[model samples]
Target: MDREIAYGAIGARLETKLNETGLSRNEQAESLGISRSALATYISLERIPSASTVARAVDRFDIDPRWLLTGDERDRITRDQWVAVLSAFVELKAIMDRLFKDRIGWHQASHDDRMKVYRAGETLYEIGGISALNACANALYEGNPGAQLGAGDMLNHLFNGIGPWRA
Candidate 1:
């Protein structure tokens, strides 16, 4: 990953963890032996967290260090899960292409907007499997009440349904 993208992923993961714990920012920072401002910087992606900071978070919260940095749990995913995810990605891409082509013309859509839709589909798949993913796609394709929302709004709705575990 690019340095900035990696840092952003790490920050997102850290923020997810902190939110999951439901502890005050000051308390979480205190447990990690860092100032609240420092913790804020890390979560805001303004700075890369040091190795010790990562380690402390790993130990304090029982987080997988790899997941904290990479947003993946390779060991936890079985072969079947990989296959499902890959299949879902392919299916989602086709659906999104068609949907965007009809609505805004896929070629005219910004790359970032397309990525948001794909990411939202992936998150839905993770949470409730292929059925959930398909449901979201169907909603968008069928012209549901919220179907007219922009990519960012659709992303927010999809992400709001995700639990902390899926983060």
Candidate 2:
């Protein structure tokens, strides 16, 4: 297949994932670490995501890269992979719930303090069989209308240089 045609297929899959997450374009952009206009270009099939972006999506969403790129619906991930994904999510939820138990925003914390927490999150993401899943969940919760104050603020803090864990 031509590269453009393949990109179009991938773009369609990206659209489907975006709809599945029920997030607005801005939220999706943030989750993907891309700008809104970049996402727009992707959705319009004007350009494809970079390799890093594609890898990020796979890690962040538990997406099967093969299916994402080729539109092959067959499950590429093994049962073990699925289990690991679920387990990591459960662990991450526990971790976040514990970290935010006080329900006070870490937004006001110093940079070093926040960086410590952000580093923790990054470590867990690397070693816990979950890649930026916590951030994805945060973005998801933040985007949802019913999400309250304690949800999804970590990513914002971390990205904005404030970090995520409580000081």
Candidate 3:
């Protein structure tokens, strides 16, 4: 199979497992010890899951790794499922927009910088769902420079992987 097809199969299987668990995306990410963005990337077939992530998914979700890599006919994503996933991504984009709205320099920031912020927000969402993301945004929106500096520093550390905090 082609690499992209394999990844799509794996992503579909992962999405199947996620649906089986009936957990929210944030809860699923927390259980898998990955950022929500990582999960999204996997589901969107933008990236393959790492070995460790696959292992964790196999163990945590009782999924057969082989089946995950090459899903059978039963595992295919239906049109409704695909639509639902696209809808979720749209909602996520809306959330990201809200996260950056009214923030200084957000409009002027480069695309890369915007992506960094989106990634940071996704990490925060994994940590504490929407509330955590909201807190980060609130911190930035607060007129206090110190709070904004702290939030900015936290986001920078998260994006660069140069901090004591793991998440």
Candidate 4:
């Protein structure tokens, strides 16, 4: 996943909020004491803006930080956490895409091979299983929603013998 693209999307959302408030980038820069170019970068999501900068923009325009960071002010996630997760999820999705490809590949399509792919996909999705069967079951039950877990959990599940204790 390209972190830069994610950051840029957030910046564009922030710029949208400012536009709706009738506030220009120059004004926001002057008021926040940040460089206009920096503010522009924030608008472009080219750079991850600080929490304080987000707060200032929110306070100044009476907007919400969550909205600026995630394009959804109503989302409950914090600004920084959302940014990190957004990048992480983008990467996770890429991993999952590979897994999907493997699932269809001839080598991994046979009974044993498909099972292997499924077992490995389980680790990527964080359902540490004692064996291929166990992992396959978990992957089925948990469905794709479980894929939201972080890479650490996925790695642990994939490599570490079952759960944390078993490992």
Candidate achieving the largest lDDT: 1
Q: Runs in model 4 with CA error above 4 Å? A: 1-5, 73-167
Model 1, span 1-167: residue lDDT tens: 21212434666788898889989999999999999998998888776565457657867886665456556554644445434544544555555556656786544656775565556566545634433443333333333334434433444444444434366
Task: Give the per-residue lDDT digits (tens) of candidate 2, residues 1-167.
Answer: 21222444666788888888878889888999999998887789776565456657777777775466555554476646544544544544454555566554576544665555555455434332122433334332433423323444564454344223323
Prediction 1 global C-alpha lDDT: 0.57
Total backbone clashes of model 1?
Answer: 0
The lDDT per prediction is 0.57, 0.55, 0.54, 0.47
lDDT (C-alpha) at residue 163 in model 2: 26
Question: Model 4 reaches what TM-score against the true structure?
Answer: 0.39
Q: What is the lDDT of residue 61 in candidate 1?
A: 81
List CA RMSD, all candidates: 13.6, 12.8, 16.0, 14.0
lDDT of 3 by residue, 144-164 (tens): 545445445444434344232
Error of 2 at 44 (Å): 0.5
Number of clashes in every candidate structure? 0, 0, 0, 3
Model 4 Cα lDDT, one tens digit per residue, 21-87:
6666678788777899988777664665654565566567665444454443344445554344334
Model 2 lDDT-worst window of ten:
126-135
The segments of candidate 3 whose C-alpha lies over 4 angstroms from its true place after superposition are 1-5, 72-167
lDDT-wise, the better of 3 and 4 is 3
